[model samples]
Target: MDLQAVVDSLPRYGEPLLTTIVVTVASAAFALVVAFALGLMTSSKHLAIRTPARAFVEFIRGSSAVVQLFWFAFAMPVLLGIQFDYLIAAGIIALGLNYGAYSSEVVRGAIAAVPKGQLEAATALNLTPLQKMRLVVLPQAWPEMIPSLCAFAIMLLKASALVSIIGVMDITALAGLIGSQAGQDRLVHYSVVLVMYFILAWLIWTGMRALERKAKRGLGVDVKPVKGRLAPEVAAGGVR
Candidate 1:
């Protein structure tokens, strides 16, 4: 808990932490793209598109991510007769697919929250489906979606800890290594790891809160000025 000890500990885990951040960011980006496409498909008018997309999302969400990671890391190579580095393949396949399903729900919800009036207006404008979605719907939907997306990103970051199970050497794995090195002080080392994890989670939460506030203000929902003006409107209306 001494400042110097914490600093020294960080250096030992620095490389693994960097790897964890890189993998999480890359996989989450891929997941976001996949989720957007699949979620759109799930909401498609065509049963042909929607059913399969729904099925895929359900399958990914229902199964254990740890099992999926193992399958991708081990069974995939044997099945395809291709070798992949453990960390790279696990990060790409498992984290990407798992988060993709969750992000799909976020996408679906955001799309649904787009006002029906806007859709009707788009129709009146004679916009094609794609044009309406791209120009009108998505632009509006994105702001509503930002908070959920940030939450999903943070969840994905925590989930990346599971990649260490498949030999990826993420933060959790590095923590385990450090704990082992500390021997009888394993409990202390792991306590430090817990603190690190808590700090990381807190940072993510704080960042998301800031984003939520920014989005609210950008959407004209921040109430400070509105509250100040309310008394005058009430007095003018003779309600007070």
Candidate 2:
């Protein structure tokens, strides 16, 4: 195999790889904001608030992300009468909205799973609704939600690949470009690209693990299961 050729060709793709990372990171951050906002909105006492939140979550989840990306890139500019740098915005919004729909459930589930006694205690303490959520409920739920959020972040990273189709020149795009110019076969180019993806994924996994441990530092002496696919444990520092 022309391994040396593949290795030598990699440096040229660095900028696009960075583009891919930027898209994924930016999307993940935006998705977290959307997920938490919509998730909490679902719990509102008023139907007006809850219904729309539920509808939006379901609507975004039900739709195809690729189609959404296309729309953001191709259709939104015309419909909204606003121009866009679709190359960037399309990937970010489409990935964020799509995954945010799924991750919202994680946020909701974590909040819902908090024991009833905790809520009652807050009520007994005369905590305001905002105060209770901010200080009492969320503190307990945050650890549980981290694993799921990280899972979505990983999924978002993979999904960001679609952005390349809209001319983002990300991994697949750069790989193909380099392969063509260097006269390398698919086996050589794609194999190298796959390794690059794994490296990025590993870095994210390790960082998330560290954050998980730090988040649980004050939970308690006993370990509690973090929800989602990761299934890690955090000590019950205090919240339980």
Candidate 3:
């Protein structure tokens, strides 16, 4: 193996790894939308709303993500006779649907955790159910939801690696290619993949922390840093 060739090939992986980040972020955005919609629906008092939301969440949650990814990427386009970008559509939908189902419970729990008195206050103010959720409940529930959503975002980043299995040339896929070229340097090539993953995950965590702080702002809570990261408890309701 030419040492110079190995060093030079590393930079080539950068673009592919960046795709991993883009896919994760896009998937998370899609998933969050699904989560909030299903979560709120599941929490609805009416059976008409709650039953379908519960069914959607349960079906997605119970299904295997690997199979889902393959189905959307490989089988769906063929089965449905629809043309689409297999890599993008499949990764986004699979990640969104799978994690969206898992995180819906988190969103539901956070919204439900809002003080009952606040709900009463909204009712007294003659606010519509939609207005109540938009203006009052969500504002309070958002802070509590941040930490859990951040965790799910990190999980999404890791799960995005699975895209390689479906022929998406993400970081892991690049690493496989790099290993093939580098011969006995497979250890080094894959080790770099580990570092890439850690850095991506850490970036996700840091961005979420910033969003967490912003979410806390409405509560007038000042977050104290702990071990170089703000404590979620402080951001939640620890203000004096």
Candidate closest to the true structure, highest lDDT: 3
lDDT rank order: 3, 2, 1
lDDT of 1 by residue, 2-109 (tens): 545545777777777777677777887899898899889987889999999999999999999888888888877899875676556666778899889888988888
lDDT per residue as tens, model 2, 1-240 = 476777687788878888989999999999999999998998778999999999999999998998898888888888996667556877898899999889999998999999999999999999999999999899899989988888788888888889988888898888777777644776678887888888888888888877777778767623445456342333434344
- What is the Cα-based TM-score of model 1? 0.84
Cα-based TM-score, every candidate? 0.84, 0.89, 0.90
So what's the TM-score on candidate 3?
0.90
The per-residue C-alpha lDDT of model 2 at residue 171 equals 84
Compared with the true structure, the alpha-carbon lDDT of candidate 2 equals 0.85
Cα lDDT tens digits, model 3, 31-130, are 9999999999999999999999999899998889999998888788789966565577778889999999999999999999999999999999999999
Q: Residue 223 of model 2: what lDDT?
A: 47
- Specify the highest-TM-score model's number: 3
- Report the C-alpha displacement of residue 56, candidate 3, in angstroms: 1.1
Task: Assess each prediction's global lDDT (C-alpha) against the native.
Answer: 0.78, 0.85, 0.88
